[model samples]
Target: MSAYTTRQDLPGSLPAAASSALRLGALASDERFEVTVRVRPRAAPPDLAASAATLALKPAQQQQLSREEYAAAFGADPADLAKVADFARHFGLVVLDSSSARRSVFLSGTADQFAAAFGTQIEQVEHAGGVGRAVAAPLSVPSEVGDIVEGVFGLSDAPVARPHLQQLPEAQAAAGASFTPPQLAKLYNFPTGVDGSGQCIAIIELGGGFRTTDISNYFKGLHLPVPKVKSISVDGGKNHPTTANSADGEVMLDIEVAAGVAPKALICVYFAPNTDKGFLDAITAALHDKVNQPSVISISWGAAEKFWTPQALSSYDAAFQSAATLGVTVCCAAGDAGSGDENPDQGQPDGLAHVDFPAASPHVLACGGTRLKANGSSIASETVWNDDPLRSASGGGVSDFFDLPAYQNGAGVPASANPGGRVGRGVPDVAGDADPNTGYQVLVDGRRLVFGGTSAVAPLWAGLVALMNQKLGHHVGFLNPLLYGAAVGSGATHDITVGDIGAYQAGAGWDACTGWGSPNGAKLLQVLGS
Candidate 1:
């Protein structure tokens, strides 16, 4: 007894790699789990295009909406939520939770129940991340609710992304030129007299966790007060710190680097599973959390555009759009694997250049990497971070998914170096020192290790944004449009004019490798403040 006699395909619901995965067996019928259903927004979002233009030209004139205001205006429709909940009841699935602000409904049921509800076969599949569950075919929903449903996630729990982090070997780490976060802040000339006292930085972590003892000891070593840090569990993910070789490195690095720069800024970490559903849920939760009300968010995890589903990409981008309207800035790591975001040891498996997602999303502040040499407190040399083109390097290139945005018009962004040579949005909107040979010294699992990658760069930029927000007396939401315009010629950045990253090179003003170069904090603050 279903609500509708017919069914329709859920757009962008199938993972690109699903068909290629090694078939293990049918999923046990009695196995139980949860899935998230994304409902369409109540109405079309506000004119973000016009808002972006204004934010670039006259940030002071831009109007920001609070969390409550946004929900009331753009959240899901009550009637639509009721229809979805009724549909779930018809299929014997329990409605675990629902949120208008996030436009999501959490449903729990057995594998057989989900298979019946979505009109798909659940099966065990072997992917790079090991055995997991996935739908053997495209997901479908009751025709009555098809148009109202944006996506159905957690049907497939394959690993979605890897942490964009690189740690040097103990021997090399001990011998390399590494600097503490404070030293880098000084070199970059961050604005003085502001410690981000009133701002909250939201950090998204897919795996791993941080220890209180580690946070205390690390800050004590730096001679700085331990910033208040809190954790929010998403989809059952929590702060479970294991060993140094695990994702704890990424978790600790993000916290230490961001806190080290903005000592008094409150840090809220949202831990989620490394699945598409978990990732998206974590982002929405952070963006809509009224308690924390983060002014900026830092994401150090992502994969190439090719690995993601069309629905997941659009959904995540939509969440970021909501972030812009709420006057929140999101900083994302570009990638550590150069233009080819896959296994570097394999040498471009498909031979096509790729850019990491979330970073490639035009709405985010895409942070790239650099190698630096300092003389005293001033930088002697800075270049595109490329230690091995076939391995570690700053990921940069034209995006294959997103179109070229208006803000990059005068920046001379080049087309993708791949065969088709299609023009698209360029990446690494900003950069920072990320070479393991010239990395940041961080404490992970009680071990002091040197880490580098675009991962460090995300939190580094997030920390700077906190300081900027504190100084400007407002949130510097959606900073890309401004960065490409006024901040370009105003000495707000260091403009790296040397080196390359395999498929692309760096020179003059904006290039794929370093995107207008690293920060000159004080100058950037002045430009934004004006």
Candidate 2:
């Protein structure tokens, strides 16, 4: 018999993929696993309405809290933690670790123990990718702790996201123009005299790894000092570099672009597994890291919103809100798939428009893609990046998950191009060069390569944010509100008015294809500095 006689459903605990996956059979009773339980904040978080008002203010006027202060005010409640521990003990689970700042309690147990504790069965499942474990039913918690537990993760270890990166095909790798990060910075007129000194930029990688030798050689070729890079493991994930064809491209791309543009800033890379639990844990670890204290975070990994669980979406969004209050900026790749956002390589298109999450999260600076033809130091032509509509393009569309934010109210955000035309938040809040034809020249696993995608754009903006912070002597936290407000018409961004990505078209001002267009870094600095 279960320890608790009565249980309540844990809202949003079911995996979205579980519905379609073919269930094989129950897991072995003694199959061991570890899970993370996300709990509610000790106190209610700051009001969104008020936070919007505050974020709209100039950088100096914002009342940002330090990590210590934020933890004290909004971290997990001790009582809530104790209750969860008691519940875990009753079900024969061992408490692994807990963090007040991250509001997470880690536990280790067998399949049978977890099944009894959460009132759900773990089963071997067959999906398109391969066989894995997943929950077949909605998870439930004891009635006493139902409200305190926000999400239960790691019951299913299916892959959650893909790296938003595209390597130029070998056949055409030499056919188009590619610029090094420094050259693009010059073309974009990034602010000079600041090397992101006194700032730390955090990067999150779900897989692959980076070699110091590659980093040293890459920067040496560029004649830039190698930025200090450190890898922090999350959830047992490590810096295990493999071949160039693997996720190494993403890890290398993120590091090279960010460090290339902000050579003096400390780069802290948080490596984790590719599951939803690993993704969320990597993010929270980077945000709450007091030692490194990243002023901005760059995430080049994400999937379409449809692939995520509702609990995962809400939990990740809530973490971004914490970033805003702590004065840390988060830059996420808007995705490589176009408005449809379906994985063409895996199967046929779903024939419906979709947007990517983390980028779709209202709090993040969603970085989009553009194709640029530069005339020496100046941009001759720039437009929406859409080499292949179904397979590769700058991802943009109205989000089905999040409502329109106040800052985007006047940006002429359109309804979802899909049926029912639901109104929601638009993606790709900003843009950068991201076409494989005009991609960034990078070093991956000691091999020179050209990589593109909104993947590169996230780090591009992250490096720019670090430079901006160094120049302004403050973190330009939560830039979307200000970008839509004071920075409009300020010549801070070059408005791309050409090209289209299937469901959306590029326009003079804010459009779904490339919101407010690509950056003019010097002007952006002046706008934020003021």
Candidate 3:
């Protein structure tokens, strides 16, 4: 891969077209420049076909594209230009000057002209979000599926499970488990001598600002310490006023999970509004986060590939690399969407990045989700969490972009999943509680909801990093090398033993879904302590 195109960074949530370029005019000259642009989705009306729980589109607005031709538009990332170059070269599509985070960039030439030349519709290239969301449809819940699974597993069992992770698990209440810091800390115990008192843990959230009152209430309710949480806003996005959004819900879960697992650590949240610009800007700010000097940053947001560009990846590559030099460990969600982002169309490399972007970046750690069943003192059955195509799934799969990093080779993970087979870089390096049906309990704007997704895993891992820093005498910058080759018997990590997240089934060893399984907090501390 050439330097201009060899970027292996995690693709971000920003639309993919935002980074493209082109050879403008009838005469291809250096004067013909490229500009970043976006292909926004037209509003789709509410229908039974909706897969997303968040706002749905208005309807089949395909005709909306014919009039999309524009005489002017501007201000996109240089990446948008690359998209133009890449797409045009691949399909002879023209490049347009107009750009945006939502609207797809036009190729400037008339749609009919492009159709005449390429034999393909040039006006609207489908944004894969809807298509990707459809892949999990196979996992949809059978109205009685949760009951059947729970019944067979026996809900009366100690520390049982509910259909969702974030919802109030009757098992948690029945087992007398409370979401207190110390009690939960055991789940992330640093090796015997570890402590995180001096380390910092930074959290990246899109919305759902935590209030001082909520902190007091949460801690007082749990009889735990009030974590030191500092709020930082990026791209000038302000603290959200509180609302319901998967983006914000995921953010809240990240903070609470990290805090619960590593209470004594300093927690700083970098907030960005729920937009691609704010999301990208927030991460850039986190990479250079001052005052906090956080050795670990946790992220839990993601979108499909094709939605991002190499330039975006290159920009983030710098940050991830910087964190590494600074000894910071970057953790991200592997997306809640599953494998190949499922496309019914055909097997074309998803024009998009896979799973989670930043997480897919070779510079960071990607975390996947799992559904777990625990008894009084032991984790009974654990499985890779996929939203029963019927329910949805935790994201996991190989990247069409990022190259395989050195840390990816040893883990029994086959080299084939790396289709486009040229690149390397595996994902969900480490994971923990992310089964929304069996997820953690929480309070957001005083509203209680059950939640789980790869979102919960990122921060949970960050909290573990804080404790590792406490024990190792410094931050455990990138944990992959350490976790990947460790002996299977090393009690430090638990190998997930059941269930399946999409195509990957949970087994005795590492699988694509749950990377070393969930942590054996107590033993992990013992091993890391050594």
Candidate 4:
């Protein structure tokens, strides 16, 4: 299960940045609450050193695992999971669901049962945009269960993640010509044949909805086949669209981008709440889903790493690790707020360098933003996306949380410039066009809208990865090792050398702003496919 919490050093209260002391109201004790118990991974991936060694070898020499095989090798111990479930039942919590592969136990009970079981109080707290219920105090479990439970999430109903997609205003949209995703794909030299048939792409969203008419109309306009699009709800979240929420734009952008590039691929959209619990559960569910079995998953929601709880961070990282063990490639947006990644609610920029989570997680491919200038079907000039200081910019920086992974050890990496004197993981392992000035056009809610952000890059990369899988006739899981290895210098990517993202600037090879750079799709397929 999870680490047994015994030491006093374990965090007692939520991070000041994550929880609020101000109570707006209180939740009724009779209300039902759904909480998740995240468990520890069965074991660390066989040996990071050995794994890298294998990656260095030819594709034929690489060891690959099917989902079932991977679960057998890396999933949580069943007995440990049972122990957690037993504890939940002891506290009068109903066992709603459990997944051994994801090492998670889902429980539901009245607010009174939850409060009594976890030794924490729940209260309605004031939050940005609206008021929500959340855990108001430190959570502590029995010594036995506390040791095994990695994180007790879903107790709080706080909204944490922000959708990375930003729609262009009417003025901005009318200012320039917007390119459809396929048009952009062609300019980037994405292969013409191999339309991602027989491949599945999973798009994760915190909130948003897309209409079938919008998607069908979009593909019809491009004179391409309309790929299958399906929605799966998680943690009571729905594909609900509202005029007040711009999240629907994010949902549509992700789907259209991936589907446009890989027109024949099946697109599965996972809609979850914007809270940490919902985000974590969605990822875990997507990672462990055996039916849809997406070859690649794209995420366009995230918050600054510092805003997440320790358990939240570890649990999410563990999920990414599991994706690596399985033959699944995950792509996440680096954020749109440059290096500062400041909280908008904080009044002004903190002037501190911060990185977005899920993107910063070592196991996933973090996609940054770029401004692309293309003439007809050829790329003109691409630079790091940096708009205005007060507005959006490509997010990239040394992480305040994760350490540098072994794959990131070589050239194009900088040493720690922070006070901690620790070399943390650098972001934007790969990048794509995300500037609204050169954004992707999509049909959302029956309206044609242009949007941009690192959000577009995640699904764009995921679609490219799906096409690569189709062309190679196999899944290329966990791209970092390959992207950083022998194929790096083999013309697989277009290195961006201009522009900056707040505190960090772009340069040759790798930089915090745009990493190795944008894709040269066909060449990448050839190099990585080999």
Span of ten consecutive residues with least summed lDDT in model 3:
151-160
The better candidate by lDDT, 2 or 3, is 2
Per-residue lDDT of 1-530 in model 4, one digit per residue for the tens? 43434432225337536454368666788888788888765765653322457448543345667778877877777877888888788778999988878788899998888887787788877776477677777887777755567787888777778888767886889877678888888887887678999999999888868888888898999998988998899998788866424788888889899999998999998888888788988988888788999989999999788778877877788788778767688999999988877646444655667788889998889999999998777888999998863358898888777877888877456754456655688898999999998898888777777899999999999999899889888888878888888677888889999999877889989899999999888888777756
Higher-lDDT candidate among 1 and 4? 1
Candidate 1 deviant stretches above 4 angstroms: 17-20, 47-52, 345-348
User: Cα deviation in Å at residue 74, candidate 1?
Assistant: 0.9
Off by over 4 Å in 2: 1-3, 16-20, 47-52, 127-130
Cα-based lDDT at residue 48, candidate 1 = 52
Q: lDDT tens digits, residues 398-428, model 1?
A: 9988888778877798979988898898998
lDDT of candidate 2 over 148-252, digit per residue (tens) = 999988998888888999999866777779999999999999999999999999999989999999999999999999889999999999999999999999999
Per-prediction count of colliding residue pairs?
Answer: 0, 0, 76, 4
Candidate 1 C-alpha RMSD relative to the actual structure: 1.6
Number of backbone clashes in candidate 3? 76
- TM-score, predicted candidate 3 vs. hidden true structure: 0.64
